[model samples]
Target: MIMYLLMGLTAAVVSYGATWGARVVGNRLELHMPIRSRDMHSTPVSRLGGVAIFLGVLVALIVASQSFFVKDIYRHNFSPWGVLAGATLIVLVGVADDLLDIRWWVKLIGQSAAALVVAIWGVRMTIVPWVPEPIFLENEMIRIVLTAGLIVTTMNAFNFIDGLDGLAAGVAIIGGTAFFFTAYWVHRNAVLLDYSDLATLLMAVVVGSCIGFLPHNWFPSKIFMGDSGAMLIGLLFAAAGIVSTGQITSGLYDRANGISTVIPILLPFAVLFLPLLDLGLAVVRRTARGRSPWSADRGHLHHKLLDIGYSHRTAVILMYLWTAVLSFGGLAFAVFPWQPVLAADIFATLLMGLVTAWPYLRRGSDEPVA
Candidate 1:
């Protein structure tokens, strides 16, 4: 536990330094994300923030590979390298899109290619969820295809919500923190010693990167993460989920009842509930209006909050609150009695709901009872 925390701190420090370097390079190269119709920022900002985040994760992983406690993970398998390669591939694709505004199909192809790289290197999804029997995707081909599809989908889902300063990075921090704890528990409890806490290690790096990046990305930002940063975050999350939940054994599932069985299946989604929900809504809303799902618009939840009179910082913070509540709730379920966790989650959700609606309701009351 202490080792992972130290690794995360290492990642954060490296990422912070790398972000400053990236900003300077971006300015020199004149690479900026121009203010678009759907964007919130008024001025053009450097979009090379992803490069810094990637560097931070890279340096931390390299250090981990040399560490006495974690070096065994490298010898165990090549899956960790696969995540690095995939992250590198996705960041390149994102950088191109950020600079050139590449065609949607081209970006999709790039995402698929990156996903395939991770899948082929033995991080394929091996287990199926929500079934009576512990059904594992034993066929190597099926596992690869499922894993790639999931990675691609998750990348896009996160990309869709990178609309506000610090939103994507902050959410990644929340999700990665949740992932680390759950993965750590599974590693200690389960019989899958071969995985060697790979998911936890990956998330430690991810959360650290986001922590390092958030200051530069906060409201009235100096730099936007652009497609590269958001997609990299999503890919890392998916890869960690694959290694964590996708490796659960039937023995663990069968032996434990109550929350344990469900948590392994639900933990990934619980952490990413908001982004995935926004993604689902965007696809449906666009397709219904005969627009391409990839097309940008101001109908996102964050935009809605803005339209309803929330300040930029407040809207982002509220979203963070919701993400934290859902994420930590799931983490609690895994460790404690489900009944209390569920009750607390419900109370927290109601409080958030009231907080969200209070402004509008107060405005209505101020209006002359017409």
Candidate 2:
């Protein structure tokens, strides 16, 4: 616990320091990216903010690995090393894209390659908990392909939602917090080893990084995370999800008791449900409009908020609130044994979703085009 707190603080300080450094370097190098939105502030801001957060996380992880709390877990599994390598690759690729406006294909290739590396490190998902009996894919190639696809999809989902200031970071913070508790719960139940403690540490670092950076990122932003930060965050979260859900311990699901292990698997998606849904919606919306799915547009949820006369700060706060509600609610359902609480959580989630969409509801009757 002390290690986790120390790591979190270290990550926060490192991330904050990086942000300061990036600001100086970005201005010196004239690395300002133009904003296309009329709703945005007049001044151009640097997009290399993510470079700082990436560095902070990298350094914090390295230091934490040597700590007593992390040493055993780090030595027992090579997964952390694999994750670090994958994160470095993705961050470098994203930084290149941010600096040079690299081709979309090139970015895609990098993401795919990173995903493949993680999969090659045996990070593939082998079981679907909803199905009776453990369903293992007999074909190794199929498992690798499916796992890589999941990682890529999750990575892009996070990247796609990085449109608004403080949006992706806030959502990530909430998701990371939820993962911490979930991992801790699993560890406490003795279903899994203390390695979940490592997940908690990672979560704390993520939370601290986001919180520290939010001051610079909120509303009229001074810096943007750009692709560098967004892709790195996405990749790390994806890997964490894979680690947490893929390693199901014995007795995790008692089929006769009507308990489902799908809940744990579903936890990641639920924590990140909003962004993933937005990505899906974006693809459909773009395809329907005869544009490439990867094309950027003003049809994002934040854009809709602006169109509906919400302030940037309000929109961001609303997003943060919704993310927290969903992520926590999903986690509560997953870890708690009581059916009543789980049912109540489900009801509350549905209610919150409705409330969140209330802004869109008022502007309705005439369907607003995306």
Candidate 3:
């Protein structure tokens, strides 16, 4: 536990330090993400914030890898080296894209390269929990493709939703926290006796990095996370999901029978549901309008909240609470006898929604579109 806390602290301090430097370097390089018409921020901001996040997670994992518990996990085949290599590649791609406006195809190629590293590291989703038996997809080629696809999808999902201030980071922190607890639960249960504590430790570093960076990222941001930070975080979030969910060999997980075996796969998606929904909407909306999905717009959920007269901080806070409710509700279902509190969660969120949107609701149903 102490080692874990130290790992988180190391990540936090490193990230905070790196963020400070990233700001100076970004400003010095004149590498600002100019305020596009569709952008929410009114002024240009420095964008290579991923530099800090990358360093944070990199150093944290190195320190964590030194722990005997973590070392044992490595011996059991959960190696951080491969994930780190891939993450570094992705971060570079993101930084280059942020600084140089790399072509989309080139960016795709880079992301795929990172995915290849994941495959080479043998990180694959071998089992998907279902009733009666687990669905096995351990064919090396298939696993690589599937795992790589998931990583890319999740990475893009986050990239797509980096529309509002502190949006992606906050969501990530919520998701990472959920993932950390879930992973810890799995590790303690020792259901598979295969995976190590890598998932939990990775999540700790993730949560720590987000917490560290939030001081600079929230509300009126000092620097945007840019593609660098967003994509780096996306990759880490996906890595934790993959590690926690991919290793189980049997459908009969949770021998004590609280959550089902599929919780590993289900949990991350539950946490990311809002972002994923936003991504899907963006793609569909863009396609319908014959625009590129990569094109920026102000049609995001945050935009709607803002348009409805919610202050930026309030909007962010509302989204944060919404995300928390959903994430925690899912966690409860997976690990606890949550039926008792389930209705309360629903009522509370609904009530909060009513309160937040009451002004718009009272005035009229018609609200201005961004």
Candidate 4:
């Protein structure tokens, strides 16, 4: 735990400095993103923030490699290096798209290629980790495909919700924190291991990067994460989940810890609920209108909140709240008694719903929201 915290702090410090450097370099290179019709920000901003994030992750891994506590991970597996390789590929693809406004299909191909890199390097998901019986994929090809699909889907989902300033990074911070704690807990209690593993270490680094990046990214932003940062964060987020799932074992299935076992299957989706929901709705909404599923539009959930008169910051906060409710609720179930966790989730859900609809409820439908 202490070692993971140190790595996280190291990542945060590096990311903070690198972000400022990235902004300066981006400005010098004239790499700012111009205002889009659907975008809310009025000023052009640097989109090279992904470079800083990748640097942060890379440095953190390097620091980890030097630590005796993390030596076991390096000796036993190639997953960490695979993540770095995949991140490099995706970040380059994203940087190109940010610079050239590349075609959507080309970006998808790049994203798929990045996903395949990690999957082929042994980050593939081989087991479902279900309760009654864990479903194992015997064929290596199927595992690779499944893992790649998950990575691609998550990358797109996160990109879709990156419309609001700080939205994507903020969500990653919250989700990554939830995942880190839960994964670490599982390793300590269920796996009976004292040292941190790949998933928790990755999550720690990811959360740290986001923490470092958020001050620049928050509403009334200084720089946008652009496609590069958004896709990089999404890829790392999904990779951590894939590695975490593979860590589950039958030991978690004990009757006393049934909830903990179930969490391994559900927490990944739970943490990503909002982004995935927005992605699904966007795909369906676009398809129904005879447009490409990936077409840009003002119909996203965040857009709706803006349309309903919530201030930009408020909408982002509401999204953050709901993310916390669902994700932490799942985490609580695994770590605490179910009855209390259930009560807390219900209360939090209702509070979030009320906060979301309060504008409409306070002001009659005939009047605009204050």
Candidate 5:
């Protein structure tokens, strides 16, 4: 407990300091991405805020790894070096995009290459409990591909949802905190004990990064995360999920009769359902309209919220609320058994769904913004 708290504080301080430094350097360097055609911000903001977050997280990891109190936390089969290399690749690519307006294809290629590196380092998903393992490919290959795909998808999903001030950072913080508890519980349960410590450390890094950046990023934002911060956060989330699922005890598949192995894997997804769903919806909407999926537009759910009379602060808060609801709700279900927790989740989700859709449903009427 002490180790985790200390690590979290270190990460938060470093991330916050990095953001301040980035803002100064970014202004001097004029590092900014051009306003997308559909952008809602009236003025340009520095896009290099992600540099700070990346650095902060990197520093936090270094500190945690070296600390006596936490050395054992990540000394097992997990490879922090691989995670760092992957994060560096994404950060470099994102920074290039923010500064030079790199084409979408270029960014995609970079992300794929980075993901492949992580996959090759053996950080991929290979099992889906209850389902027969793929016959054609070896377990190693399956792990690499699945892990790489998750890394790429998560990186992009996070970038896609960075539409509103504080939205991405807030959600990242909430999701990270939820993962921390889940991993801690798994540790206590003695299931995947080898990886539990590392998982907790990773969660601390994420939480620190988000909390440190929130002050400057909240509504009436001074700076944006740009590709750098958003992509890094996504990668961290993906890595955490991989770590959690990878820690499952082998042969437990045969022991658990009714539930699927996907139960643990789905936890991260449930925590981040909103952003991933937004990404999926964006892809489908763009394809349906015969537009490039990468094309920027005001059709995002956040934009829709704004269009439907939500103040900027209200929209951001609403996003935060939903993120917490889903993330914590998922954690609750995971900590408890299916029957009781699932019932609670169902009731909570239904209430949230109604509230979330309320804005859209009342669009035609003269309803006041509640």
Candidate 6:
């Protein structure tokens, strides 16, 4: 526990410090993101903030590995290094997109290449998360393809939700925190599981990075995470999921700890529901209109909320509320027979719905949202 805390602190401090320096470097390099019709920010912001986030996580890993206590957490595996490799690849593409406006096809190629690296690094699905029983796969090719697909899809899901200021980072913080605690709990309780400690460390590093970067990305932001930061965090989240779900070899995983043996697998999707929905809808909508699936538009959920007259901050907060309710609620239901908690989530959803629709429900007032 002490080791985890110390390592997380190290990641946070390094991330925070790097973010401050990234701003100056970005400015000097003229890595500024100009205003676009699809964007809300009026002024250009630095796009290399992701460099700081990556540095922070890397430095923390290096520093933590130097400690004997931290070494023991990962003594059995080298999966974390694989995660770093894939994430580095994505960051390279993202930085290129941020600075040079790389084509979407080019970015897709880069993302797929990164996913392949992750798959080769052994962070892949060996067992299918199916009903009745989990079937273990012996075919390495299938596992590699499936693992790479999952990683790429998750990376895009998170990038889609990076529409509002602080949205991606804040939502990630909530999701990562939930997974981190669950990993920690499993480590303390699932005594037969050798990889629980490793899972916990991966999640801790992810959560700590978000915490360290949030201050620079909050509402009315100073520095934008841009594509570089967005895709990097997304890859981190995806890699953590891959490692936790696939790297564990314990027999106990077949047995349900609370509600299901697949909670870890389902939790990532639950927390990421909004983004996935938005991405899917965008794909369908664009295809129906004879546009490329990757075409940029203002039809995301955030865009709708803005169209309905919510201020940028209000829309972001409402999205945050929705994300928290679903994410935390799903985790609670998975881990406990908490009936009241479900009811509370439902009630909160209703309250938030009423607030979101109040302007429309009023049936008058031509004035726009102030």
Give me the candidate number with maximum lDDT. Answer: 1
Model 5 agreement with the true structure over 1-370: per-residue lDDT tens digits: 6778788888889889989988888878877777777776887788878888888788988887788757775566556667778888989999998899788899999998888877776366654433334122357767787788888999988988999999999999988898888777656655444433666777888888889998988877888888888988888788878766765544322222234354565578887798898899999999999998877778887888888778888888888888887888777765566687778888888887878778777774666757
Alpha-carbon TM-score of each model against the true structure: 0.95, 0.90, 0.91, 0.95, 0.91, 0.91
lDDT (0 to 1) per candidate: 0.86, 0.76, 0.78, 0.85, 0.78, 0.77
- Per-residue lDDT tens digits for candidate 6, residues 119-234, read 88847878766555557889999999988998888888888889888888888878777777666655555555343365567667766777888898887887777777788877
Give the clash count for each candidate: 0, 0, 0, 0, 1, 0
Give all candidate RMSDs, comma-separated.
1.8, 3.5, 3.2, 2.3, 3.3, 3.1
lDDT of 4 by residue, 1-370 (tens): 8989888888888988899998898888889767789989887888888888888888999889889687577876888899889999999999999889998999999999999999998488988777676788999989999999999999999999998988998999998899898877766775455455888888989889888888888878887788888898889989988887776664642422456457777788989999999999999999999999978899999999988789999899988988898888888877777788889889989988888988877677667658
Q: Which stretches of candidate 2 lie over 4 Å from their true place?
A: 37-39, 191-198, 251-260, 359-370
Q: What pairs collide in candidate 5?
A: 50-229
> Which residue window of length 10 is worst by lDDT in model 6?
251-260
Arrange candidates by lDDT, highest first: which order? 1, 4, 5, 3, 6, 2
Name the better of 1 and 6 by TM-score: 1
Estimate, for each residue in 229-337, the C-alpha lDDT of model 3 and write its tens digit. Answer: 8888877777777776765553333642455665765678878888888888988998899998777788887888889888888888888887887777666665566
What tens digits encode model 1's per-residue C-alpha lDDT throughout 308-342? 89999999999999889888888887777778888
Report the Cα lDDT for candidate 1. Answer: 0.86
In candidate 3, residue 342 scores what lDDT?
69
